[model samples]
Target: MGDENTPLGAPQLAREAKDLVELANTEETVSELLRRGLDWLTRIARFDLATLFLLREARLVAVAARGPLANARVRGHVLDLAAFPMVRQALETRRARAFTEEDHSGEGDPFDGVLDLPPGHSCMVVPLCSGERCYGVLTLDRSECETYPQTVVDLVEVYGQLLATALQNAEQRSDFERLHRQDHEHAKLLESQLGGDSEGVLETSLSPAMRDLARRARQVAETDTPVLLLGETGTGKERLARAIHRWSSRADHPFVTINCAAIPAGLLESELFGHVKGAFTGATKDRAGRFQMAHGGTLLLDEVGELPVELQAKLLRALQEKTFEPVGSDRTVRADVRILAATHVDLQQAIAQRRFREDLYYRLSVFPLRLPPLRERLEDLPQLCAFLLDEQARRTGRRGMRVLPEALARLGAYDWPGNLRELANVLERATILSRGPELGPQALDLPTHVRAPEAPAEKLAEDKPGKVPTLAAVQREHILRVLALTKGRIYGPGGAAQLLGLKPSTLQSRMKKLGIARQELFIIEGPT
Candidate 1:
């Protein structure tokens, strides 16, 4: 067995190599492959000890051990490159080295304090190398009373080569899986962004301001940065947040929302960070919080300005560390969520008053977007009305419902204090009351309490250049004058509705649809 020329030795080595190749090919996991390889070496090669150390995080880790030390403690033992010179030399030179009693003269013993080599035992360290890279070092030990065969050393070297190939294949497979997962996640986000089966839509088509806002939102949608949406109430901040989620890489995952102001302060922490089964009274079972539920996706923190000061520090820590412990659990869970914060409150003022944390604000406002109010984007009224009227028509069993120019002028004249939400409410009401093909001024009796555009010094100046008074405008003006004359009364005999030849309810609905307010009209009674 010690002579390489022995005819039987070649066939035995060939069979051992074939068995190892089959084992390496069949095992899927790296740990399993190493375990089987060590077992084969200990049994077939008659080694007293066999250990497989693989490179991990720039160090060699004892992934599998057999023979004398087959305990759990030996499996994860980590060896630094500088601590073991024999393993280092084997790895660097890409060659197997043998240490025997006769070869240990002046060197004293390189294996001393390094490996627990049994007394009167010989050892061989083989590099598990393929191509130019060495994956790790394989060590085998046996009694020195019998000569260690050169055939056995060659067989171990061949096994090391096959192990290196297996390790590389396993690593490549892991990389492929990771990339596939990332691609799947990206696809989901794109699908949502493209409005996949979702009722949400960005109304940026009719207004340049909205278009700009959408453009900025799209720019930051692919990143993991926190977004702060600043706008007045009813400006569609939540809708914009949804758009960001759809466009982000995490679109495939959940998009969870939490209204801080709507929830009680006492329950906010548990709601955000989750809790164990016995975290508090009435806690029947464990539940995931919004943060955990929104993992790998977007979390919309609506009215985030309402979060209490004490919770701000916790939130900041989670955002910074990407980890948080459940209410009653000592285990820290990871957070892989993108945050979108929406609020109508003045955060700067809140910070100044010590009601909000400055650090939290900075974290939340990494990319801030301010939505324009409806009054500032009146040019979009026609498109907005068209979309809204279509929605109203669908809801009210009406078809082809179009807004007259006069009705649009009436709508464009007033300041929409409630923004898009108010507009939707008014249009919905008008659709319910309309009995004609076109939505006329009579069908849009706007509230008389909101501010109207300042009247020009003269009636001629109000019309654009050569623009004549359309019947709608004339009707709107007439209705306003009568409402003022009746002191904003709509019901009864002397009411504006009676004078306008309409039912009181129909007239009231029209006023709401028109964005008119009696107080606003009365305020401008003496003006042009």
Candidate 2:
């Protein structure tokens, strides 16, 4: 930026910046840039392992793996964003910082054990964050005993920012590519249903639950009636809604989604039914509501159960009559959208409690699709993990990952009350933290509360110190205890599986394998 022995002036600096920006914006593929970027960081940082975890869906995904990590191709291999204190701080505030081993060791931090590196080396992870979200992190673990200096931190932040942008851009490019490739294939199918005859759905799931959902979605796609999707939190309801749209007559139109719980009640009404210019404070321009934007396509009302009661009647009117006035406008706008709504809550209970409109409920439930929780679909965990890990590897072109069978076994037994979304997060967390060839239970930051109970008091007193039961034994005892407590039910509340950290169906299979019966242990299933 400067002449020999002299400082550069403003114009020269500006020109240099423009040149750098151009270099960054070149048509080189994102994978190439990411590879080169990691190479550069490894040299500059002198670390043993390095990787970048880009956000996908709602979880962090390892797009690039470098340095000393063995076998990087395992699916959903990632870290929990909300669980990492350093990442949480950096991303939420949009500030760059690093964490060392000394900062760990808190009573209830989500980031425990993440910084434990090979040898005597510590770890450093700089967040690749933008706005309120963290796209990924530039992680480095070094064998040297020296603490990181300010210069290294600054360099890591810059590299992390560029890497995150490259990752985000690559994902968008992939989406465009997928849409292009699938659009033609789905033409006949889209036309049959949405009048456009689209047939295929996004390959969002490798799990049987997802495949089944897609199959059932095809049946609902051809109908003109409203559809309601019911599931626990973290289930991919919006993704399902979009799949429905892609196969419907409205395939050529927009698909819009708005979370009822993410917005305030007063402003949500105006957001859904646009306010006139200057209708109230800050209404400076004419705007089209989500409905208008999604006209002729699908309007996904996410978290629909959270809509305020006052607006429930209004929503019902619009659903039935297909017309609505703006918040401050008297003109009635005709709606041509196929309404698709989703909620994690039980709407029947909401209606009974007078928190929802029964008429609206009837209309939406005309075509109902219930997304089974992750626990119900434990049979699909292995496939889903493989798909997600491979997708991440394919995106960033890493070495790929390896998942041990035992790890998968433990994973399938998890309760997954948070559902697929949670399962995805757990896998994502494991991807970033795990090294070498196999993913083990220690790397999986499952809720600490999920650990096994102490031995029964009688057994503990009888045993020698430091001896622990095998995982299977622990699981068996836990199930037996739950069976005694519940009296009997295998699939309902207080069921053996729920009492333990497992799906009911898994418990049943285990019980059958172990030749144990809830009926023999107890006499009742809880009230439904």
Candidate 3:
């Protein structure tokens, strides 16, 4: 050896350097990779403590720690840039800084207050720099009155460079994976919005109301103006929102959505505006929220009326200024997202009730489109059934499934209080229950009180000559047939009332007017 206190030989340093490079290249998650790097640092440099802090939002957040302070729960904790002089020196000068108890160079250092190192411990800190940017800082400390070897210092500097590159790679991989997932989900949503009809052959609705609504949506989609969708629950506001996105200039970009009512009020702000690391107890890492993710795209705020009062002002600011700072951060981020809001709740009433902001409502409703409920657009029933059944068939692997004409007619008669969503549930359930290629009235099991609509001339033309059934006549026939099938039992399980999906009392009244006697019908022995 050159000297008794000499550092490791050049050959040994070279070997360890090669190993560190190999370790950094391994396929692992960011956290796992960082943990393993810390372990390797301990073995190679023989440090009593090693901690890694990554820069996020101009603060160094503790990501990994080891040694005497290893038991400390400092991971996910943040340290201000100016609070630690040694760390600041290392970062700004792009060099390693070492200090011993005897040196007393940093007697008034802020890190002295933050870090409670034991007496006689020497510490070394290095900046993780790659090119011009410092990725983070690495610290090593030992509870001994000895200085770290020159070779060890050199190795740590190299390690910092390697770690920075590794972190950048890992972050890129993570971003790619997240974007891939978002793209896959958006593709599925787009397919659904197109009604799985890639050729554009399927019509959304033939009803004049819906046609007018679609026309308006297409007209406004080319602009960056905010669009508000107003409709009753399940009236397909989300679908309309998708249509607008597809027709917009940002059609190729992401279309993110959030249901204000579905998420808790306390978390909505964080979900929309993101949060810096250590912003909250569980916010371990920096996350780009919906606004960031939807940059250069569209964001649909469904159930917008459910937004809490306190957040309304912040939302209005974001809408007006297109910039918002993440929670616990002072820096503002630009939001280049087109806003689309959809809600069934009456915004005017909500404003009058002091539950919503009128300015925000005006901003959102720059181009408003109101969708008529299914009951009002009954003319579109046949087409809606076809489109819904096609989707259900594809999902259930029941290809080429169809509904019987009479069943379709019966479905058009009911007042669908729950709108399209309810219709979809009913159709999916019917598809799952039916055994044949065609679903009939038995598969429908509609409530008898919901009578079919008046038969149009075309429907009457399909009837037997001179025997076109009126709405009342069809109701009577449907009720009488149900009674006969139930062996004239009028109430309870398997009774005429139950089979017809009618309340027992209502079925009895209909029977009395139709001249069906109690003697002619079997009375079930149970409560009506």
Name the top TM-score candidate. Answer: 3
Deviation from native of the Cα of residue 74 in model 1, angstroms: 52
Which candidate leads the pack in lDDT? 3
lDDT of 3 by residue, 411-490 (tens): 76677888988898888878778888788878985656765658899987788866756777778766654454444567
TM-scores of the candidates in the order shown? 0.49, 0.48, 0.52
lDDT tens per residue, model 2, 334-377:
98888999998999999999999888789789988888777665
lDDT of 3 at 97: 66
Model 1: per-residue lDDT, tens digit, 1-528? 233244235677577667766665566676787777676665446666677887776688877788764556666567777756666777888877776666545344433554565555767878998877778888776655454577767666776787787667666676787898897788666545433322223444544577778778888997888999999998878878877887778767878899999989989999999999988997789989999999988899999999999999989999999899989899999989899999999999999999999999999999999988887766566677777666555556687888775576567666789998888788777776788778777788688777655776896466685476776676676666555445456677656677677998888777777667766555434344
lDDT of 1 at 523: 49
Runs of candidate 1 with Cα error greater than 4 angstroms are 1-206, 389-400, 451-528
TM-score of 3: 0.52
Ranking by lDDT: 3, 1, 2
The 10 consecutive residues of candidate 1 with the worst lDDT sum are 194-203
Candidate 1 shows a clash count of 14
